[model samples]
Target: MFKAGRTAAPRTRPTSMKIAMIIAGTVIFLLLGLPLIVQIITAFRGPFLPFGVSSAQWGVTNFITLWELREDFWGVLGATGAFVGGSTVLSLLMAFGLAWITVRTDAPVRRLISVLVIVPYIIPPIVKAQAYLLMLSPESGVLNQLLRLLPFTGDVPIDPYSFGSLIFIQSLTNVTFPFLMMVPILTNMDGSLEESARVSGASWPKTLRRVTLPMLWPGLLGVTVLTFILGLGSLEVPLLFGQESGKNIFSLKLWTLISSSSGQLPQYGLAAAWGLVFLVITTIAFAVYLRATRNAERRASVSGKGFRPSTMRMGGWKIPSMILVTIFILLTAILPLLALLWGAITPYPVAFSFDAMLNRTSFAAFGTVLADPDFWVALGRTVVIAGGSATLAVVVATVFAYGIARSRKTPWVKAADLFASSSVAIPATIAGFAMFLTFMVLNPYIPLAGTLIALIIAYSYRVSIAYRSSYSATLQIRPELEEAALVSGASQLTGFRRVVGPLLMPTVMAVWIQMFILGTNEFTLPAFLAVPETRPLSMYIYAMINPRSAQLYAPDQGAAMALIFTLMVFAIGYGLQWLLARRAIGRARKAVAAPDLTPLSAAPGGGGEDPSATVTIAVAKRRARARVR
Candidate 1:
């Protein structure tokens, strides 16, 4: 007989289930994957007119234009390389440092550092860019103003439009991502090896370099690939500062190609070519990420035996470490926020001044923004669009992830998984361009361009994120739960609804919360899809600060609105997160207090001992080993 708790592998699934899987796979592909395919095809075809490619012919014409534009393209490519590479490396370094300090050292305010580092991740890049513009704008900026007062300082001390500034701000924004990813790895590391290294005369630095870092290569490699690829698609930093510094990047170039000067037609073919190059880069990066993660099990440092994480004692360096972490917190969280608050309360044409803040500070800007009917309308649209997209994305992602977990070997399932996850590599800029083309093509039949439906579809691209989370959660759960329900005469759908659904609800809610926040703050997709009538809050704020929008260029107003927007998102996001954490704790406590009713030995195929008995035997073995040692 088969081992206890193991079900017989089904050779065939029901035809209805097969049909359902196929339909689900098709829907996911059509939504997430088709855009990339369209861009690839459009690259080879002729120019995409306002209507369609009806008069276009297939050739290397776009590639020819790409070649003709090689000078501008190469300049942009170099700038992009510098921006993406610098930001990725810097962010990874900062993240790793913060993770190490918080997890492995006796750093001050470790809990506070952990919370503050993640705050920047939720702040919109546009908001950050605006704040920095006020804080570091060389002439009128707050920091520069402060610097000019120094006795030894030059006339201009800091340049916000420089590559260094761009990299620093961008890195600050995303450093929390790798920090979060690295924390568990650092926390779970076995300390015995480190202690042995110390016994063998290796110093802390050498031990970290030779022992700890080698073990962390796989994780670092994965973080590097993802962060670099993400940097390539970044729009706001490069858009705001790149051209100002004569360092244009690919995303900005792509946007210019689409929304060219009034007299010029959009260079759709060249934009497609540029996007294809980006795709190629991300595809290679993702492949490397996969290859590195494939052997992750080998790098696993934790064990069933007593596992202790290494903690470094900072006798003399603790204060310096605290200072460094404090500076990081100031840069990543406090400074930008303070700048925004200052800008919001100050008069129009905002300037940083304590004098103005104390004397001229008025709540009028807040009132002005709050009282605007357009602001209310935009806020409503943002809530609906972000909430609706997140809900739809989570539902589709759950179905796709469930299908992937249950039928990993199915060809359609494999394809769907690839397509759904691949969107992570597709930058929002390229995705927006593709969506624009798609909606324009279908405009005659559907008339969706410039509509709320278009925004919803565009924003729902967060499916990849939800899919990854749900897929991992699904795999952790045992198939026995569903099978037992099936044995009790429950249909497959009923088993999922009655058994697996509750189990997965927590993960589903967390993913929904994350996607909702992301969709709400997302700028690139809505910029491409939203019209005046359908503008979300992000778009509205963008219009306000945009210098080109002469009629609406009110940086103070934008600052006030963005401040309120940030507070609302933070409250909703963190409040929901707190609730989810509480729910999770409640469920875990219930699980512990409940009876061990799982069918470990009484499973249909069971004949021998229970699984708990094996665990008991292992515990005895471990105890005996401990006694012998």
Candidate 2:
């Protein structure tokens, strides 16, 4: 009877567990999967639907019309190709140089340069566009004025509104993403291969050419593909810089088709067609990216044994290299910030002469911004929405990751993982459009559109992939600890809360901060879903700079708002860093004070336990002590 009872209990538990996993997986699929399904249906519904209409007759007319609009379509595709290619190449070269210098060379002020390299990414891309516009504007640019003062210089050659200028500015902003991606790969790479080549009579340069670059090929390819995809989908940079120059890309074209300044009805079906085309392109690129990443991971097999790379001494080139890097940082990071400050204070764009500085600077624009009650209300609304969205996203992602991690043997979990991972490849414009249609057209009874809740849902869809990735990595922690807790008479939920949660806290905190920053800076979804009362800071700044708006072309006021927004983001980021640092230090101190339970087998006249056994016993003892306390 007892043997039969034990067998039955085990079978029953597995069945229950499988049922729970199935339910959770189904919910996640519906939440994320339904939007894409709706988008496809909407695309087949053709370009015109009556107002407040939820249903449309299915046809292939939208695709046919899109094919007929080949002139505009081809032009946008060509421009997108050039922009994505130029930005990707330039960013990769610059990021490689910076990463090599910081990670492998003995350069002066390397730490400062390392910190400054990420500044461009930290500032929102919209603000980056505004800063360049201030500095490179042909009529009132400070840099152009300084150039005109030079001998034999008639007019400044820089054209801020040109396609070349668009690529240059966008490259500066996009470089940091690849830089961050490459630094760790370069830093942690095994140096034994290069050292062996050098020892075999190869010169340093030859060794690097033969050994280092080859080993880094996979990583480089992965970063290149990823950055190119990002550049392909970028909207704000091209929207701000290329819109006036008649250099529209696919994203901008999609935006124009769906949003009419002249009060013409929006061509919803045409926009859907563009999105479908873009989706196909992104899907192919993303597949390539995935393959490259898998290859990189497979190739990155440094031995577990300790081995540190040797740094190259720059000799006489150190100072010069450092100076060059410093100048680049100043141009990319500091100059943009200074431009924002200058724009905020001046009555209008002015040359950076001493007279202009002394006569034109004031706090009037900032004061005007501060005095607007709508500005305050918008700021408050943004804080709440961004904060709430980030928190909710972290929770949902953690739950989803937990389910996937614990149920890895189940086919349902595998399907869930694939769906969540593939979500990242969807462009923000497409995701926003899908969400917009999902709520506003397909399920209007839900009442999510034009509210903060809708914005939260959109942001979560965009950011949950990041959290899932983070949590999945952390979930690699062995399950033995949780099993130990279970054996000690705790329920499964209690074991997770007590044993796993604390261990995962650091990763959870990091994900929360990342999601918070992404939500704060997000613009695309808010543009699609946020009503006027629920607009975020990104939309607020966009309105100030929008040419069609009645804000009197106040780039100065927009600059002021940008400066404030940047400071707020910086503060939140640094504050969290400080708190995490302090928490880590506190843990170190507590660990130091804890009793050392080194096995007695290591002492004289003690029972001699095997080394492996001794280590296991010590760990068990420590855990027991922790439980007691």
Candidate 3:
């Protein structure tokens, strides 16, 4: 029907869609990238507002100020290096051990251990620090109180403020990320290579070192880089435990520069200069990881054929491995949680005594915390912040994710993806500082400083996270579904809404809950922007125990507040998980109850059998397994 020498008109998106995409791209860039740009420019300038505010000359005055604090800077750098390095090493060791036992070795109660391992990850960083503070503080610390019971040990045996304690407590939760990273790698790794080495007379350790580890180099490197980066940006642990031990960290220095409470104006340039160090370090580390990943991929272990992942027989080591895992779980998660409970129930800090716990335990602290009007106000504000930010992040991320997945070659859409992900390298601390500077610059025009809108906007830095998750989920779905909807006379937006949205619901909820938890627990952004009226629960808890807040410092009441907060978080997490599981189970049952009809000629056996029926049955079984997972 086409005429020769006539060209078909090119396909083009509707003008409305094009304009919407442009607006979205602009907003994403402003929301995510503008703050960093503002901070970078501020670093070059003196202590003054940006955007034509009258201030000092632009030079390396910030660097000069840094030089003036070189003595303090170097010491903080050394402490930071030690803390990050030590925590990285310890976290990797623990994570790898747990992953190996759960994935490769025949360990008892592997399922239970796997679930227990992630428990600490769910606990807020500040809560974990507070738990240890209760357990290990030299004076009135539960552990020290118990230690003094020994006749031979007259003085306190440990100091919670030491670097050793700092690394240990940080490693407790930091282990979860590396553990998550390694689990999939180990689960899918081919066992044939290790088997061949073992059959060739290599010892288990030799085979592991030469064959298994080399194949896993890329994953190990990725985990190391991420864990190290997390360790570097840590704020709560160092702030809580490092102060008394003189272990001033880089993050704390940045906090001090911007949020100094000694009746002085904030040194914006100095804080930005300090924050820039994190940006630089993260960039270099990420570059190294990319190069290493490419080289390591040359020796890929997984393939479509001959891929066998077998669990190792623990043999005589089974009991020891089980006992060791049990002890690790107890020490890392259970003990710390119990410490919180004890602190909450007791009128004051005391060693664990069953007699006293039964006879003298009081819910008075819980009652006191619950009775405060400020507590209720903080709780309400936290819920709104978490819910609002999570919803906004998911929406923005979902739109960008859909565009990136659908329009692979579109330049503007590709740029939109880039702008959205540009914030991933910026840690919460630096991002918070940057937002602080940005709001100050725009305060005259926007008047959003110290507002809930400011906190919500700041927390949406996790849009990058949500985008990554949604993008992966979106890619798994075939575009043909959308095409089919469009062929049936639906608009593009309608097709996406009716076809793709249903498929993405599970991923959407997961990302939302994750961002929600993060928003609830994070205090760095709130630390800079929150005033009294807008302060959320995490900031409230931090202030409660802060030594500077002498009048507000009440460890017992803070313990009660933190315990309640932790319970609420856990309830939300597990309750939603349970609901999702129930929904999946119901769908699976319906899938099984449904019947199918197909031509016998298409069946494999071809003896009056229906291939469609077999497929339906197999799909139902698969859904069952997915629910279990």
Candidate 4:
């Protein structure tokens, strides 16, 4: 009789496979890290040619020049601080309100409200900026026009291009982010804390202040830091709205140093210097973020028992609260969208009036955009680069995650993870600049700058950072399933393909779609790396709205292109969501039909002596059952 309890010899991966994994990890680390190395070297080099071409003579002149040119540096810093600080605070407040209403209260139409809140985020920031500009431009804003129609209203109520307006626009664009972050924390928090407070004779308000707020402090702080970092690095909003109002933030200042010729050579060294400054700021912020999250995780108080938090009854306030949320959605998403639609049709920005609507409304802008051959080229390039980069990033990240998960004992895998994660602290503009320097310095042999390939590389690098974190989590959770496959006479590749692959498909697809959305809207990377022939739609839109581009500046045409792009993004997002939903349903059905074959217990002196033996026995029994069938 066969001894079913006998332990088998330990399995090891092939030597060639181990070598290949090491090689891949090294390549990933180098690719992700090379840009920073280039930036550091470029920052210290002396300016010799136009656009700060490196002289190879190392010195502190760049830093000194940056200091001497600091006439308005303090002012720019003040503006940046105000923009980042105000946007963070306001965004947090708005997010808190939305999260509380939706998660804590018996708010009307919670599902609709949640969807509306996320809609603005789905709309690209470039498009949102254009919409806001149309609605808030001082002389011809549609909102201003509506106000003028009111009694005794003469001038525009508010200028869209002011510092305060910058904060407002940034807050509106970012509110959904913190709201998304907070909702899950609010949903998952142990309800017992709040229940105990209420039971101790505390009023709802007191309970919230003492119990709920304290529990949420970590998430709140983490989101605050994240939002502040995002706000600080924001380029499009400041470039579009702040520039006209003479508000110079650090990002815009850095852009000007790199892009503006101003009848003089571009200050590449100074730009690099500025990039270093921003890098330091981002690094410090990231450190703080890490600490806050660690502390929050330590303080987490989830209980094993499943209990739902009680929702507050809105009572007489229900209808009014719903109205307020509806209004918020209208202002945040609908109004901007309507503004874009109006601008797309009109010949120029105009107030809402019957005459303007009837005569000025036409598809001339779209016709112009579509008629141009360059538009088609740009559109094709955008789709290919965005889709390709997202796909490539996901594939590479998945491989890296798998390698790291399986080879946690290997030093190279740890190094790869560290290098990839560090890229998160690098700001987008700085990353773009770093790519620019890397390509420029090596272009003689490699010839990558000013090409679509370079843009793809930049976008892939940027996205892989997020994918690494996502894939790492999913990989960690399912190692035992893969081990079970291995125990049942499956090779590593076969096991991953048959077992882990199926489980990871949904997560992989979600990451791919999100990365695609982000890639399509990417501005800074393409802005620095793209040449005229290789320009993507994002660059096209930027040119149309750019005040300095006299020949290319066409607000109506830009709005038309933005609207088209926005619709495309939404279509892709919705399509993917539907597909994933159906896939999930199919999986659920299959799971229901399948018999449960999980191991009941471990037998003595068996391979079941190991922790993973249960999974192995379950898988083996399932295989035996399948053969019998």
After TM-score superposition, what is the CA distance of residue 550 in candidate 3 from its true location, in Å? 3.7
lDDT of 3 by residue, 239-325 (tens): 787766634677777777776585788888878887786688887887788689977768788899988898899999998888888
TM-score pick, better of 1 and 2: 1
Q: After superposing candidate 4, which stretches have Cα over 4 Å from the reference?
A: 1-17, 48-54, 149-154, 201-206, 244-247, 315-320, 409-416, 464-477, 484-494, 590-617, 620-629
Per-residue lDDT, model 1, residue 123, is 83
State the C-alpha lDDT per candidate.
Answer: 0.79, 0.75, 0.79, 0.76
Per-residue alpha-carbon lDDT of candidate 1 for residues 1-629, written as tens digits (9 for 90 to 100): 86789787979757554566567667677777777777887888867743465688888888887788778778877888888888899999999989988898887788988988888877877887777777786666767777898988898887777778888878877787788889987888888888999999999889889988888888888788878877776777776776666346778888878885446888887888888888888888888788778888887889988888867888999988888888888777787888887778777644566676678888788999999899999989988998999998888787768778997478866766777787777778888888887787778898999998888888887689988998999998777666666666666666665667777899899999988898878888877778889999988998888888889888789999989888888898999999999999998798555444342224332357676655434333332333223
User: What does each candidate score in C-alpha RMSD?
Assistant: 7.6, 4.3, 5.4, 6.3
Give me candidate 1's TM-score against the actual structure.
0.90
Provide the clashing-pair count of each candidate structure: 0, 0, 0, 0
Number of backbone clashes in candidate 3: 0
User: What are the per-residue Cα lDDT tens digits for candidate 4 across 441-537?
Assistant: 7788788878888888888876555456555666555465656666666666666556666667888888887888888888767777898889888
- After superposing candidate 1, which stretches have Cα over 4 Å from the reference? 1-16, 49-51, 261-263, 350-354, 408-415, 582-629
Can you write out model 2's per-residue Cα lDDT over 1-629, one digit (the tens) per residue? 35454444435454433444465455455556777777777788855542256556788888898788788778777888887788889989889989989999888778878889988877877788788888777877766676687888668658888888888877888889999999988988887777788789999789878888888888887788778877766778777878766356776777777776648888877778778888888888778766666756656647778677768788988887878787778768988888888889987777787898887889899988888787788778777777787776666566556657876567765666767677667777788777777776744567777888778777777444554665576567667665676667666556555666676777777777777877888777776677777898888888887777785357788899899888888888779878987998897798656566444436343276567665544564446335533
Least lDDT summed over 10 consecutive residues: which range in candidate 1?
620-629
TM-score of each: 0.90, 0.89, 0.89, 0.87
